[model samples]
Structure formats: structure tokens, C-alpha cells
Target: MGLFGNFVAGGLAGLAVDLCLFPLDTIKTRLQSEQGFFKAGGFSGIYKGIGSVLSGSIPSAAIFFIVYEGFKAYYSIYPPGSTSEAAVQAIASALGAIAACIVRVPVEVVKQRSQVSLDSTKSSLDVFRETVAKEGYHGLYRGFRITVIRDSLFSLLEFPIWEQMKTFYAVYYGLEKTAPLAGACLGGVAGAISGFLTTPIDVAKTQMMLADSDALATKMGLLQSLVRIGGQGGLPGLFRGAVPRVCWISIGGFIFLGVYDSALTYMSTVAV
Candidate 1:
């Protein structure tokens, strides 16, 4: 598909995924939050920042797939079934993640802040404007470095594993390509792995983003944040929300990639 198609499909898929599973994401954030799980709001609290999440997810995902698919097309010179396919996809995914960071970082900051707000009544736009006013434009981009690291690693792990799994299914099942079910299943598996591996980084990124901008007190770097987290509860503290994170990401991957592949397939047929 062309870049524009990727943008639209990716946006729709991402929007659907995030909107459906935002409560889980909010739970994951709270689980990883410094507020501690009990104080982070319970079941109903999971939906606190959902509006912010949706507002950001659509555009963020669209931009991500635009870059990802564009790079994938540009790097598609390797022959089909070639050994380098996974490697090529990994490179493209990483590159796309880097570009995606530009939009994602701010959205994350707002979403996270809104989720953790004590008032619990603030809207996404309220949190966004407050952040901008309080911390200037840079406030929205807090934790940019760690965000890049977490997202890039997620893409690096997720796309390669997903592509390889699809290849395996195609070869073993003698299918022309992965069926939608196959893609969704494998995508869930890939997302689970990626989410687990990146949870520690995610912990640090969330802590940094949720840090109080009022006093540069939490302006710690990645290493510092990790150390601080370790101090809180040792290594276990770093992976505070592994269960919810994995569950949400696995489901999100299934929906996001399922819809994405389906959209691309539809687009291809239409073009033909």
C-alpha cells in the first residue's frame, strides 16, 4: 500500500485497538506508576485517562505506520522468502519508531498525567493545556529519550518476531500468506514478548513522565530513574505491572495488526 493508505489504515487500526483496550493501558500505567497500585485508583480508575489516550493514539499510530510502511517499501528490495526479510523488517520498524517518537512522546505525557491526576475530572485537553502552561512546550516532551528507547525496542522486537512468525505459517501451512487469524495470533504472541521485555524501560519512562514538573526534582535520566525504581522495591519494582501490561499489549497487538493487515488487503484488492 501507499504511504497515505498506510496512514489511514494504521490510524483506524490503532484507534480501534486503543479505544477498546485503553482501560488496560491505564491500568498498566497505574501499575507502573509511583503512586503504587492501591493508591493509583482501582478498577473504575482504569478508564480515567482514556480520552487522552484516544486523542493521541489515532494520530500517533497513523504517523507510525506511515513511516514504518514507507520504510518497509523502500527496504523491500530483498527477495521474498529471503533470509534477510526479518532483518529488513526490524530495521524498518526501528526507523519508523524513531519517527513515531516525535508525536508519541507528547501524547504519552498528557495521557499519563491525566491518568494520574488527583482531581480525576480533568479532560485530555485540560491536562494538555495545563502541561503546556506549567512546563512550557518542553513539558509535553518530558521523557523523550526513554520513550524513544522503549518504543524503539518494542518495534524492534515486535515486528521482527511477527514477520518471522507469519513466514513460518506461510511455509508450514503452504499458504500464499498468513490468514487473518494466523496474523492475529502471531501478532499477540509477538506483542506479549515485546511488552514483557520492555516493561522495565516502560517503568522508567512512565516515572519520568509522571514526575512533577513543578520542581525539576524528578528530572532524572534513564539510569537515574532505573536506580530510583530499584531503590523503591529492588528489581521487582521495575516490573510492577507485567501481568496487565502483557495482557493489554497482547490484545492490542491482535486488534491493531489484524485490522491493519485486513485494511491493507482490502486496499490491495481495490487497487487491483
Candidate 2:
């Protein structure tokens, strides 16, 4: 593919993967955001509101990927069909991820609230309204900036690294052996890497949204939460949901890459 084409390819692939499994993200966030140490919702609770997630995520992925591709094209420093520009591609992916996260934060808030708000009777609209009324309009976008940073950083590091890793694996093991499991491993590693690296911020973001409702005498800032977590649980405390994150990411990574690679190849032909 040409530079433009690669840009298109990478973005569409990312979006495709993101949309297919966005429900898992909603699940993951709620799981990570639960109370108590290692607090995570069970299988059913995480999977709640899958329908609503799809209603928003699929198109959101499309927009993210397209915007990412456009950014790649804009930032291209190499000629078409050249492999030396892999770094540029990586940067483009980062930019795209940033854009995607910014666009998706509100959706993230809604989807997460919808998934975890199981009061047995509150509908999605009810939950959304309550969130807005209680938290205000800006409340729906609580973690907007943090989410953008996390999503951008994770994508910037993970996607490009995964691409390079995939190439190495393909060259080392040949195409047949570098199958679903390989992709899954790459994803798991990438997830753990990004998740681990960003856990401090992740915890802070959660605490902010979570504790926003609490009218405690002691209100702590983001850095204070980090320090508090460190003081209380040390390093392990920060990564409370690391175990589930690894597992979820591994599955998601494999599915995302596998699906994207196959779908992109098909899309290339179909787009022609």
C-alpha cells in the first residue's frame, strides 16, 4: 500500500477492532473502577449494556480510524510504499488514538454508567439523566482529559510496538505459525505494558469520578490519591485490576488484531 493507503489501512483496522470489542472496554473500566481493593464486577455486570455500547461504539470507531488515517497522511515524512517511515506511522497512530479518546470520553462515561448502574429498575435514559442532573453537563465528560491522555499514550506505545512485533513474528515464524495466539500474546503484553505504565493515572481518574459523589471532609487531589494509594497498598495497590486487565487485553488484543488484519485485507479489495 502507498503512504496514504497505509494510513487508511491502519486507521480502518484500528477502528474495526475497536468497534467489534468496545463492550469489553466498558466492562474493563467498570471492573477497574469498583470499590475496595481488587474490586471488580462479575462477568454479568461487566457485560451489562452491551446493546447500548454497540449503539454508540461502532460509528465512533469509524470516526476515530478515519481521523487517525488523515493525521497519518498529514504527518507523513516518507514517500509512498516505503517501509522506512514506520516511525511516522507510529506517530500517526498516537495522534489518531488521542483523537479517538477525546471523541469517545462522553460515550465512555455513558457506557460505563449504563453497564455498572444495576439498580434493577433504572433504564439507560434514567441513568444518563441522573448523571447529568447530579453531575451537570460537564459531569458526563468527567474523565475527558485523562481518558484522552491514557488512550493516546496506550495506542501510541502499544499499536506501533505491536506492528513491529507482528512483523518480527511473521518473519521469524512464518505466517501460519504467527496466528491468533501470537496476536493475543502481543496484545496481552501490550495491554500489561500500557495498563501497568498508566495505572497511576487510571487510579486517579477512577478516584475522581468515584469520589465526586462522596461529601467527605477529606477531599484529595489526583496526586494525593496516588500518594494515598502508595501509602496504603504500595505498588500493588495501584495495579489493583492488573490481573483482569491482562486477561481482557490479551483476548481483546488477539481478537482486535486478528479481525483487523483479515478485515483490512478484505476492505482493501472491496474499497477498490
Candidate 3:
């Protein structure tokens, strides 16, 4: 499929996933925030920042897939059976993640802050303007570096595993290309694995984003933040809301890959 088609597919996939699983994402954020697990409230509060996620996810996913598919084509010079194929996918996903962060950081900043707040009535625009007014435009990108780091690892694991698993299924099991369910399963597993592994970094990212301008003065770097969280509840503290994250991202990945691949396949047919 062409870049524009990829963009549309990615956006739609992301929008669907984020909207569907936003409550889990909110719970994940709350658990990862400074309030820690118990004080973060119950499952009922999970949809607090759904608006921010939906708004951000559409554009961010579009930009990511546009770059990701473009880079995938560029890196296709490496033959499929070659070891370099994995390396190429990893590199392309990393680059795509970094590119996606250009838009993701600000959205995340607003989203996290909104999620952690007690006020459910506040709109995403309210949070954005407050952040900008309180800490300047740069405030919208508070955890930009860590956001990139977290998402880079996420895509690095997710895309490569999805592709490799599809190859394994097709080559070994003779699965047909029409089996989008297989793709969804592979994508869910990849996302679950990546989400589980990256929870600690996600914890730190959430904390950093929720930190105020004044708090930024005493803000911890990644390692320090991890250590602090570890001190709170040992290894589990670092993981925080890993269970919900895995669940949310797993389902989201299923939808994302299933829809993205299905859309591309349909588009390819239309083009022909």
C-alpha cells in the first residue's frame, strides 16, 4: 500500500485501540504516577484521560505508520531469510518511534497530567493550556527523551516479533495471507511482551510527565526514578500496573496489526 493508505490505516487502528482500551491506559498511568498503587484510586477512574489519548493517538499513529512503512520499504533491500531482516525491522521501528515522538511527547504530557488529576470535568485543552501557562511551551514535552526511549523499545520488540512470527507461521504452518486472526495473535503477544518488559521505563515516564515545573527542579533522571520506585515496593513497584498495561496493549496491538494489515491488503487490491 502507498504511504497515504498506510497513514489512514494506522490512524484508524490507533484510534480504535486507544479509545477501546483507554481506561486501562489511565489505570496504568495512575499506578505509575507519584501517588503509587493504592492512592491512585480504583478501576472506575480508568477513563479519566480518554479524550487526550484519542486525540493524540490518531495523529501519532498516522505519522508513525507513514514513516514505519516508508522505512520498511527502504530496508527491504535485506532479503527476508537473511539475519539482516530482523536488524532492518528493529532499526526501522526505532526510527519510526523516534519520529512518532515528535507529536507523542506533548500529547502524553497532557494526557498523563489529565489522567492523574481528580477533576474529571477538565478537558484536554484545559490541561494543555495549563501546562503551557505554567511551564511554557516546552512543558508539553517534559518527558520527551524517556517517551522516545520507551516507545523505541516498544516498536523495536513489537514490529520485529510480529513480522517474524508471521514468517514462522506461514513458512512452517502454511498459514494463508488471509488469516488476519493469526496476525492479531502474533501482534498481541508481541505487544504483551514489550509492554511487560517496558513497564519500569513507563513508570518513570509517567512520573516525570506528572512532575510540576517546580518539581522539575528536583526531578529524578531515569535511573534515579526507577530506584525510587523500587524503594517504594521493591520489584513490583517498578512494574506498577504491568498487568493492565499488558492487557491493554495486547488487545490494542491485536486491533492495530489486524486492521493495519487488513487495510493495506485491501488497498493493494484496489490499486491493482
Highest-scoring model, lDDT: 1
Best by TM-score: 1
- How many pairs of residues collide in each model? 0, 0, 0
- TM-score of predicted structure 3: 0.94
| Model 1 stretches astray by more than 4 angstroms | 81-83, 214-217
Pick by TM-score: 1 or 3, better one: 1
Candidate 3 stretches greater than 4 Å from native: 175-178, 216-218
Model 3: residue 252 alpha-carbon error in angstroms: 1.0
Report the C-alpha lDDT of model 3 over 174-215, residue by residue, as the tens digit.
655537778988999999999999999998888888876778
Cα lDDT tens digits for candidate 1, 1-272: 58878987898888898888988888888888877766767555667767776677778888888888877788788866576877888888888888888888888888888777767678888988998888899988899988898998899999989988898889998888998778988999999999999998899988888878753426777888888888878989988888989999999999999999988888888989
Model 2, which residues run further than 4 Å from truth?
1-31, 37-44, 75-86, 170-188, 213-222
RMSD of 2: 4.6
Q: In terms of TM-score, how similar is model 1 to the real structure?
A: 0.95
